[model samples]
Target: MTQLTTDAARAVPTLSDEQWRGLLEVRATDPGAVARAYAARRRPDPLLSRKESLFLVAADHPARGALTASGDAMAMADRRSLLARMIAALENPEVDGILGSPDVVEELLLLGALEGKVVIGSMNRGGLDGATWTMDDRFTGYDADSISESGLEGGKMLLRIDDRDPSTAGTIEACAQAVTDLAERGLMAMVEPLPYHREDDGRLTLLKDSRSLARAITIASALGTTSSHTWLKMPACDDPDTVYASTTLPCVVLGGVPGPDPAADLHSWGRALVQPTVRGLVIGRALLYPPDGDVRSAVAAAAAVMRAAHPGAPAA
Candidate 1:
């Protein structure tokens, strides 16, 4: 594993060769250490930062075979590079938490890098990126029970509703059950309800129009037996005011695939953050593997965006 470094010395902690070897040794001989590490991990009292907003670094894409970043087809395929980028992003104090799958979270726990962080386990990654059975997104990752048992603060699931596909119904049912289960445990269930349009080629395209997104948000807000523990993860749509008006649930904007221009993405995020119900940003690729390839700079710039937004929202 290459040592992860940043141009700014204070941005990311220096990782040494010994630490990498230690992680390997534990994986090879002491698999149970992951559980102990989870128990030992220190969690943030309030999931949101002092800005009263949640800025989570999303590291769960790889589990779903969604690894493209910018122009790179396999930008997140290298685990070491991915973990290094994530560690760099988390070093920024403005980042409130992380939403990751079990493998990635366990690795970070073992690295002693997840202390004082709000860890939300990612669930339902069975719908691989390019698979034909994508809409039937199954719970192949963390369940509500495992998330609670692992001492995580929350659990996140992707709910993609494709009107043309019958599998979407089953996914909605599963997500509803998950929401209820998490609520029973008093854990946050972050639901990312996305609307999709499928073409004859079987390719799924996301529908980010205000009407589509608003409907999706409303549907997601009504999931499970109760909405007490539900928080919606939505796209920073062109008409965020209209899209966000569909539900009163606390929302967080998600960073989609990295576009050609980072500034353009930032501008859209700015617009979305102004919505009264939108809380913060849950981004991954745009910051971790930016066009400039500077993780620290990307993270700092994103933090500046959050601080510049309405920083007086309710925390936790």
Candidate 2:
């Protein structure tokens, strides 16, 4: 047996041969943790064991004023209701993890639901949605040490670059420093990069040009002291082929706002998720505050899409 399979076999000694095969099948779909999986198989580390083909529902809406579900505005404004719904979702067997602002995360922490869970802290909320400073992202979430102390799994940040805007420069520099800081502490930093361009009329648009997207990827991938723990949170570019070739870093496609047909959005996501470097997804409004009212159903549907893309992949 290969080192990975051997390690996996030893880790779950209680499993029969059939169960071990099933576990190996699950690990095949997760490109992001393949190495870790291999190591786990050889000498299963408690920290590295993961489920398969899962996604983290983003509940960072309150920070961005996107507090609605299925077009119902401010649906997430009620802290108790939101927390109840989130806890309910987390309790679901299908749902794997959570992505939210520091405040929301702390709430989860207080509820004691974060233990053994994949808790990803949102690192930017200063660029509130539709605000004038939306593009100038800020690090408002848990820092490296804070994440470690909290017993959280990882951290995430937004890096929207509108070259014409001076604030983007600050965000870039701060992001680089954040990456270095997170890496030094042996934590994962998921960096979402967007090459945004503000028109003379102040309308913000993504620069879909291959060169610009590639450049943005290069800059993002090269940030921090060590790129080993860095993962790129990217949008599915107009030319996915070019975007796929832009960087060697592992990536996850981000889910934008909900569209008229949520299933179609997931279908598109399924395609993006299949890319070799695209490890998984960091879906938000599309899954949590879906146009549909059922959070459980919506989350299941999203998980189904992820599974379809890479059946039996290790869960996030």
Residue-level lDDT of model 1, residues 1-316, one tens digit each, is 2223454434433356787788889999998999899888888887767666889999999999998876767878978778888888888877887899999999889988899998999999999988878788999999999999999999999999999999999999999999999999999999999999999988889999998998898899999999998999988878887999888889999998877888988888888888889888999989988765678888888777776787554332
Candidate 1: list runs displaced more than 4 Å: 1-15, 311-316
Would you give me the overall lDDT of model 1? 0.87
lDDT of 2 at 16: 38
Model 2 / residue 140 / CA error / Å: 2.4
Best by lDDT: 1
TM-score of 1: 0.93
lDDT of 2 by residue, 232-306 (tens): 887765566777687788887888767779878877787778777776777776765554345567777877777
Q: How many clashes in each structure?
A: 0, 7
At residue 41, candidate 1 shows an lDDT of 85
